[model samples]
Target: MQIAITGTGCYIPSITIPNDDFAANNFLNSDGTPIQHENRLVIEKFKAITGIGERRYVEPHLNTSDIALLAAEKALTDANIDKEELDYIILAHNFGDVSSGQSQSDTIPSLASRVKHLLRIHNPKCIAYDLLFGCPGWVEGVIQACAFIKSGMATKCLVIGAETLSRVTDPHDRDSMIYSDGAGAAVIEAVENGGKILSHATRTFTYEEAYFLFYGTSYRPTAKNTKYIKMYGRKIYEFAITNVPKAMKECLNESGAGIEDVKKIFIHQANEKMDEAIVSRFYGLYDRSMPKDVMPMNIHKMGNSSVATIPTLFDMVRKGNLKNQSIEKEDVVIFASVGAGMNINAVIYKV
Candidate 1:
């Protein structure tokens, strides 16, 4: 049994906020005054480090599941598949259906369940659930789908990564600059003759660092403070740059492929410098100089949407949304991500 990505789709907000816009509109503290940070310096350093010039945020009325439905609709339509034909809906997210000013998540029915209802998918056999594996959730979902297909347990599956991170972001904090909102979906179906995932690996270091703190954890438990997402950016950057590349190389070796065999790499849009360094280190394993054109980045246009980044970036390149980048048939591509849970995952795929 083989799994082929039949279609891919992503939904980004219409409103694009530039770095200058952030510099102009300062986020005020709880004391009703602007937080202390040199706007010009922060903007400059942020752009220089993250390669982020602009990012998209949805309107106040939109929720997490809304963009998910839109993305799923597009993906299903692109695949020419009907709702009833879907065997599973795997939603990758952290915060679910959180409107503006609401920090708490509503995962009672699961975001995938809400999306199925909103999409009017009434097939009783179609199971829906949520996966919270940090930034690699979407890729992990695809991996799970592959298992289901290859095991002959399912025929078709829809994997989605949708997040409204702006809801939990502390505007007064610098981390807000890296948080955005979006959704991306892919339709995976069993195929006899098509490019498929060859091998993949996932790793987690829950004990090494507690970078992101949520409610009920020992790090932060107070309802008032724990609602917001906080992180040690420096630690995360170091962790990602050191670990992701090594894991990617290991996963590549598992597939009997080399660094030269990869045509492209879609890494999580966390940090520009960090991602570049990771890819460079991966190439360094074989004493090969890093190729500039292999990694396509959209962090300049799309901030870290957590789990949504990989799928969105993949769809963008696959559909010719990016300049001078394209995923053709028979091309070998790699996807990798590292985030919140300090979780890292990589997949070697043939397209």
Candidate 2:
């Protein structure tokens, strides 16, 4: 029983925050103290370093569930399936929708449930849940959907990764420049002779680096920068270059595929340079030169939308929205992401 991806969709906000916006604002620390660095040069250096030019921010009234609903509708329409036909809705997001002026998120009802309601899906048998796996949340959702379908527990599943990161991101934190808001979704169904989902692997480093990046509900004036996302960027960069390739290799080995067979690698659009380096290193392990168009990127426009990155990139390429990045039937593809929780995962897919 192979899991087949029937359709895909994405919803990016209209508001594009250019790098200059960060330069124009005077940033403050979590304690309300002014930040030391704020300049056009800083933005320039950021772009040179991360390959991000501008990013998306949701409209004033939209929430995580709102964009997710839009993406789901597009995915369902693409799949040519009714909303009621979905057997499961697996949504991924680190922070729930943050209401205006709120410093934190509230996930009491779960974003997936909210989307289910918005879609008017009344099938009690259809499970709706949220999965938190840092930036790999969307990919994890797909892997779980495949498991459910393979086990006869589900016939069709809707997987979504949506986030309004701008709401929770601290205006003072430099990381705010890199975080954005968006949603991406895919419809996966069990089909005879589909054999679409090839293989996947996951790993978590929770003992020492578990809290490397975290988001909390309230602002603490005295605590160690716990209000917004705080991370050791240098350490994360090292971890991605070191560990991601190994995970990807294992996924490929399990799929019985070689690096040369991969048509495109849809990586989490966190840092353009880091993603390129990771893929480069992964192919290096095989002692084979990487193909020129093996990696497709949108970090320049989308930044790190966490869970939304991979799915949105895939949809963009699949629809020919991205220049020089496209896929064809039976084309081999790979997906990988690493983020908070120090978690990493990789998947092999076929078009």
Candidate 3:
């Protein structure tokens, strides 16, 4: 029996917010001081480093669980499986369902439970739960599902990564432009013939790295006690470049696949420059130059949706929606991510 992802789907929000749209934002320094650079200059520098020109936001009426349900339905249709057959439903995210115009997150029922309810699956045997592992949550959920399958505890599982970062963003924070809203889901099962998961590795660093990303007050002093997603951009970049590549290399080596066999890599869409640096260092370990088109990035348009980025990009590429990026049978690929917990994880798969 081979563990595999049978179907995948994603929800890309309709509302687009361009970089120019942020020009009017009253941007402020973390210390509540005025920025010397103009909004245009700041945006240009941001675009150059992160490659994000725009991002999507959910409709006023929609929430994280709502989009999750949409993606789950599409995944079920693509898998052609009975929802009741699923033995587990795992939802990965940071903030829960933050309704539009609200600052607080709602996670009482758990996003996984909410998705299961929305799917109308009444199977009590189908365990539903939420996982908060920073942006690597989805990848970690997939690994957990594989563990269940391997240990004879489950036959099938549904793993989803969803987030509505727009609701928790601070208008005064420039880093807010890097956050967006999206959801992605995949059906995992043991198959007689299909793509297979080879190996995976995960790590969490709390030694002075735990707060690389966190919730903090707005840059504006008068914004009160309201919290928003904030990060030490330079610190996170340094942490990721130093640690992510090592985890990826370890995962690839454990998979027993040669470096030359890798055809594609789906990494978290945090920053374009940081991603490029990580991949470059990874290949350098094998004494080879990074190959062209080995990585397909959607950050230019999607920004960073935290846990949702990798699986969403995977769905897009699988459906042939990403130009010049596709996978084939027996192809070796890697999925990797880094985020708030200072967490890092990587998975090697054969398609």
Candidate 4:
């Protein structure tokens, strides 16, 4: 069975935070001039170098499921399929609807069930669950969906990677300034032809060196803070430069395809430097074996939507004016991601 992505769609909040607005709100002195060089200055430089103009954030009271529903509806409509046709619904989110509550009940029920009910899908044997990896959660979700379809457990699956990082952000912190809210969905089905997921490879390095960034609950003896994102930039950059290209090579080799066979590379939108490093390493290893291509990145615009990055980019490609660009069937599309858990995953598709 060939598992293919039939449709892709994304939803971003209506409000956009422009760079100037961000700087003014977070980095300006009383005289309206930029403050001295520091962490804030670095973040501003990140915005400028990455060319991210603005990012969206949901309303104060909104949740991840709300953004997800909007994107999911668009995806189903684009695929010419109904939500009732879905056999499985997998949600990948680092931040949930109820994150700090003591209720042991799964958060998926409230969000996913509501979505299914709104679409009028009665008792569809829905599996509403959250997959909590870091940025790579979406790629992991895709791999899991393919496995479910291939195992005859499902015919169609709605895989969503949505995040509301802004909900956990510390407004006073510069790192949190880049974080935004968005959702992306894909309607995947078992198809006889077209793009087929051929190979997947995952690798993990766990140690203090591997621990670069994190956003979650922290246990403290007296008081614990569960809502914040922490990052060690240097360590993250080091890990990305070392691990990402190596993982990509492994996936490419396992698929029996050379780097040249890949038409377009879709990497997790971690950072501009990481993207450039991966591309450079691939070309260095292949030495003219790599194809000249463009990789879409949105880290500057949306910071990191955690798991939503890859699927969101896919949705952007589908909806954007890239239709004028020359792309054809059977061209290999490679998906790669590295996340905070020190986890990395890469997969190839014959699209």
Candidate 5:
């Protein structure tokens, strides 16, 4: 069985916070020069390291659901399908409506019912649920969607990776600069031909190692204190450099595709350095002849949207920026991500 992403869409918050405003708000140098104060220096260092120039944050009144709804609507419309045609709605979110109480307590069915009412999707067979993983959520969700269709459980699925990281960011912390609010959606349909999810591979290194990057009730107590997403930068960098390439190789081996067969690689836009490291590793393995192109690191423009990264790239590709450098219909595109769980996943697609 095969699944193709027939529709793709994304929603970025309306508020655009420029780098200068960010620097000023945090009381730091605009060019990220080292400030005298240790805290200020850390903030500037974050800006310098992540290369994030601007980011969008939803208004305090808005939530992930609102952003997700917008993207989901666009995706459904793009696929020329109504909400009523959807068999399942799987939301991949690290953050949800705070007004709905605790994160996990806010059931997907309840949220989906509200969304259904708002969108008038009166399909009784539609089952909605939430799946929370780190950045690998979208890849995993797509894999699961294919399984559901293969099992005859659902014919059509709306897999959405939506995040309002702004809600979890520690405003006082410099790390917050690399987080933004956004959502992306894809309509996965079981199809025989055209852009099928050919194969996927995933691995977990250590749950303890994964705990280094996280956000939740256990991590923070109050909303006012949740303005930054913290990370052990050096540790994450080391992990990505070591694991991403290995994961990609394993995926290619499992899919029966050599590294040379891939035309483009869409990696999680976590950091610029991470991208360079992965590409370097890919070249080292393949004699430096198989050049792999990656999506323009949007971290400078949109920060890290966590799970939303891949699907956002999918939307961008559909919009005309992400494409094979060589340009061939059968050229392979490899999607990979290494997230907080210390987990890595890769999927191959024939464009």
Candidate 6:
């Protein structure tokens, strides 16, 4: 039996926040000093580097779990499977359920468990849990599902990647503009015929890169004791370009596929420039120029929604929703991501 992703879905938040929406924000330096440049210049520079002009935000009443359940339901319907038949629910997220206007993250009941409950699956045998592997969480969840299927621990699984980065961002920090909120999900199962997983690779570089992305106090000194999602932008870009390509090359090589066979690459939507650099360097590994349109990007409009990027992009492309992008049967694709925990991972898949 081939382990494959049979169905996919995503929930893009309804609220569209354009870059100009942040024009009034009091941007600050890491040391709490105000940025000398006007907000327009700042936002323009951010857009130039990250390719983000707009992003989506959940409505005031929604939380991470709510959107996750929304995506999960769609995935189930797309997969055309009874909820009771699911053997696992794996939800990958970073800051869990940060309520509107709140700083605390609520994970009392794991997001996966909450999604299962919301899905109303009564089967007690369906194991549910949350995974925190930074932005690569969703891709890693797929890897975990393949493991369970191979080990006879599961047959049908729902893997989800959701995040409310908007809720956890610091208004004073410039990096806040790089974040948004969204969720995506997929149904993974043992199939008689369809897409199949070919190979995967994962790595953690904690010795020195552990703190590249972390939770830290606000850039404004007056903000008391509350921490928000933070990162060293330059550090992450350098880390990604230097390492992410190597991992993708490693995974692709392990799949025994030639470089020309890869149709598309679904890389993490962290930054437009960083992603382009990574892919360029990836092709450089084979001493060939990067193919035209080998990578599809939505970060220009969607911003960085963390773990939600890859799966959501996949769902959109597979359904012919992303303009000029689509996947067909027997096509080879690569999924990769890098984020907090200083973690990186890549998967080789065939549709």
Tell me the TM-score of each prediction against the true structure.
0.93, 0.94, 0.99, 0.85, 0.85, 0.99
When 1 and 5 are scored with TM-score, the better candidate is 1
Off by over 4 Å in 3: none
Looking at model 6, which ten-residue stretch has the lowest summed lDDT? 292-301
The residue ranges of model 4 lying beyond 4 angstroms of the native Cα positions read 24-44, 98-110, 209-211, 216-226, 289-292, 322-326
What tens digits encode model 4's per-residue C-alpha lDDT throughout 213-259? 76533222222444467677767877887888888888888998867
Greater-lDDT candidate between 3 and 6: 6
User: In candidate 5, what residue range of length 10 has the lowest lDDT sum?
Assistant: 216-225
Task: Please provide, for model 6 over 1-351, each residue's C-alpha lDDT reduced to its tens digit, 9 standing for 90 to 100.
Answer: 999999999999999999999999999999989899999999999999999999999999999999999999999999999999999999999999999988899999999999999989999999999999999999999999999999999999999999999998999999999999999999999999998999999999999999999999999998889999999999999999999999999999999888999999999999999999999999999999999888999898898999999999999999999999988999999999999989999999999
> Which candidate ranks first by lDDT, i.e. highest?
6
- Using TM-score as the yardstick, the better of models 1 and 3 is 3
Which residues of candidate 6, in runs, are more than 4 Å off?
A: none
Assess candidate 4 and give its lDDT.
0.73
Clashing pairs in 4: 330-351
* Number of clashing residue pairs, candidate 1: 0
The model with the greater lDDT, 1 or 3, is 3
Q: Count clashing residue pairs in model 4.
A: 1
Stretches of candidate 2 above 4 Å error? 28-38, 216-226
Query: What are the clashing pairs of model 5?
Result: 169-226, 169-227, 169-228, 170-227, 170-228, 171-227
Going through the candidates in the order shown, the clash numbers are 0, 0, 1, 1, 6, 1
How much lDDT does candidate 6 score?
A: 0.95
